[model samples]
Target: MIDLSSCLSESAIQISDRTSCSKNSNVSCMISPNSTPSTQNTVTCLYRTILSTRKKILITVTWSKNSLSQGLSITIGEDPSISFKVNTNPRLFRKLKGSKSLEFQGCKVEVFWDFSSARYRSVHEPEPDDGYYIFITFDSELGMFLGDKARETLQKQEKSGPRMAKFSLITRHEHFSGNSHYQTRAKFCETGAAHDILIRRSGELEGRKNSELSVSIDKKTVIRVRSLQWNFRGNQTIFLDGLLVDLMWNVHDWFCNPDSGHGVFMFRTRSGRDSRLWMEEKILHKDEKEEFSLMIFAACKNM
Candidate 1:
């Protein structure tokens, strides 16, 4: 029974003009209003901690999928700048499963995966639900691991037991069609329950100045904005799982330029610092560590 009354205030919200785009790409993909609905590419990254050379190391596993093929990439480093990278080539058949070894800061790390029989909810999903495994071994001890068949896979590969995963899933990025309602499952916090997030825009009147935007979680309406024309960009705070969550949206393009418009929404926890700073950035800032930021893109089809 959490209430979102504080988010309706006119003076508290801040609006900005930032948009979400590929982190590793220079070309911005724009959607046209007259374009048809097509598959969208997405990337999900998991960050974890492992022991290397008796010291802690951060490892990132990124699963990416697109229309052509799907594959995974692994990066090991003490920080973002000093990292070693390896990935599976989607265009080749050998990507189903393989192993790679590399040295980072003088520490030897070996990565392995077996996705030949991985089960996925759909072809578009990059991560599988079961029937597969991914392992990262530092020196000779299993440090980071994934998949439901971890133990079995380890036994087959003759690897030792793995230390508990210190790596946490901090962020996720996705691209989806904006023409229809967009939905996804997310856990607001590390110990929070997974909720179904639904976002959609109501049709606009021919001469009306604005449209309606609705956001719901677990099938229950949480926030509704009327006269979206004036309030298309704003931020609000709500209570979820006894925690304060800061919600922000920028749908100006969605309604203002339908032919090639897209919108960005961010859900973050209020850290007693300044919510306005996060509201202005609107997207995930690499330096923010305590907050979990989930970034999603809803773009209209382009002609």
Candidate 2:
């Protein structure tokens, strides 16, 4: 395992403080080797927002794929202990469009989706780049909406239009497979720009005392760690969109199992004094403080 003791030292770095909220349970997307051959693509995002009724809630959206079909699920509530979820399985009915409705905390919530003409960049991506729309309405008002067809879909809806999304995408987790490089896109914070993040490692440094690890944002190289073998775990602060962000990573597995091991990375906003306590306590999850956190897991396979 990679040693993080030195990297986490207070003198070596200053971690931002974050406030804690409801605890979020781990949602696994791991594939079993004994299972039949099938494509496993999963992505999850957590949003913190207030409903039309002025009630705070956490919304989780998950997109996944298997050999036989693709599916999506939406969960809403203040916390996991009291949440409601809707699962849509397109493969079962062979339909690419559908809707569902339910009542939560006296509010009528409706979900609408149309993926008939969805387009994707690759098989590994569970989300469509275009030709899709997902709308979530609270009491006939739009609470959350996604995709490029939002305008067209809204024009066809009832007189009551959807409200602006009050929620902030606080956290996102994605799993992908690659050899030397892993790439993904994310918004560092609710109001920040969506950036393309790329993490690259070199094979030539496998047996050397130190390896090279480079991180890039929107194609611009931001930080590069040399002799990673000696420093596989650490944290650094970088400025993006005029906001300071704390970048943390642990890549010990890369050297331990070059072919199958996975690495973890996180991007979070810098907070005040309390943030230090959270770091010491290791409370790195969704919280009421609006301290947005994103974690990425990259699975590296042999090239």
- How close is every model to the real structure, measured as TM-score? 0.69, 0.73
State the lDDT of candidate 2 residue by residue for 1-303, as single tens digits. Answer: 124323564544542222211011121223234432212257888766666567666678888765555677788764464343333343455667778887778878787888877787666567777888988877876678778787677777657655655766767777666455666777765566777776777545467665788777665555667888887788765666555566778887777876777777777665544343134124334354536666777765632
Q: Estimate the lDDT of model 2.
A: 0.64
Once all C-alphas are superposed, what RMSD does model 1 give against the true structure? 9.7
State the lDDT at 96 in candidate 1.
67
- Report the Cα lDDT for candidate 1: 0.60
| Tens digits of lDDT, candidate 1, 232-276 | 776656666545566677776766676766777777665555534
Q: Which of the numbered candidates is closest to the native, going by highest TM-score?
A: 2
